[model samples]
Target: MTFAFPVVPRYSEIDQQGVVFFGHYLTWCDEAFTAFQASVGYPYPEMIADGVDIQIVHASLDYGSSVHWGDLVELVVENEKVGTTSLTSRVSVRRRSRSDEGWSDAVTVQLVHVCVDASAFTKVPVPPRLVEGLAAARA
Candidate 1:
C-alpha cells in the first residue's frame, strides 16, 4: 500500500530564491516515514520500547522540479524492499494546486533503514510483527 501526506512549506522553509530548500524535502520524507510507521501500527517509540529500532543507513533524493511556498506537496510513501535486517522505502514528492487535480512529480527519495537492537545498536532481524505489517502495506 502507498501512503500520502500533505505538506505545506513554511515561510522559513523557503530559500532566498523563493523555492523550498533542498534539506526540507528530506525532512518531509522523514515525517512521512514516521506517519507511515504509525499508520502501520508500529511507531518508532513503540519499536524502541520493544527493544527494536530502525536506523537510517542511507538516504537519496532526486529532484525533478522546484516547489514554492504555499504549494501543496503530497509525499507518497511505500515500501520499496525489505530484507532480513533492512527496509528500503520510497517517497515520491508531488505538487498539486488542489487535491482533486493532477499532480506533478517534484522529487523522489529512497531511505534505507537497518533494524537494530535498541540497547546494543547491533544489526538484527526485523521483528515479526513489523515484517508482517510492512508486507501487508506493500501488497
Candidate 2:
C-alpha cells in the first residue's frame, strides 16, 4: 500500500526560473516519509525515545516534470522492500489537476535507510516495532 501526503509548494521553494528547485524534492520526500511513519505509529521522536534510529544512507531523485509555486503536489510513499537492517522507501510526487482533481506523476525519489542503535550509533537489526508497523502499513 502507498501513503499519500498532500503538499503545496511555497513561493520560496521555486527558483528564479519559475520551477521548483531540484533539492526541494528530497525535502518533500522526507516530509512524506515522516508522515508515513507517524501514521503507522512509529513517529521519529517516538523512535528515538525507543532507542531506535533510521539514517538515510542513500537518496536519489528523478524529476519527470517541473512544478511551479502554489502547485498542489501529492507525495506518495511506499515501503515494499524491508531488509534485516535497512528499508527502502520510494516516494513518487504527482501534480494535482486543478479541474479534475487527479494526479500526474512528476518526480520519483528513492531512499535507503539503515536502522541503528541510537545510543551507540551502530547498525542494528530492524526493530520489531518498526517491522510490524511497516507490515501493518503495507497491509
List ranges where model 2 is wrong by over 4 Å. 97-101
Q: What are the per-residue Cα lDDT tens digits for candidate 1 across 61-113?
A: 99898888878888999987889999999999998654436789999999999
The candidate 1 region of ten consecutive residues with least summed lDDT is 95-104
Model 2: lDDT equals: 0.88
Candidate 1 stretches with Cα past 4 Å from truth are 98-101
Candidate 2: Cα lDDT at 2: 67
Looking at model 1, residue 77 earns an lDDT score of 93
Per-residue lDDT over 1-139 for candidate 2, one digit per residue giving the tens place of the 0 to 100 score: 6689998998899999998999989888888898999988788899999898988999988878888786778898999688999999988899864664667889888899999999998999988888899999888
Query: CA lDDT of each candidate?
Result: 0.89, 0.88
Alpha-carbon shift of residue 66 in model 2 (angstroms): 0.9
TM-scores, each model vs. reference: 0.93, 0.93
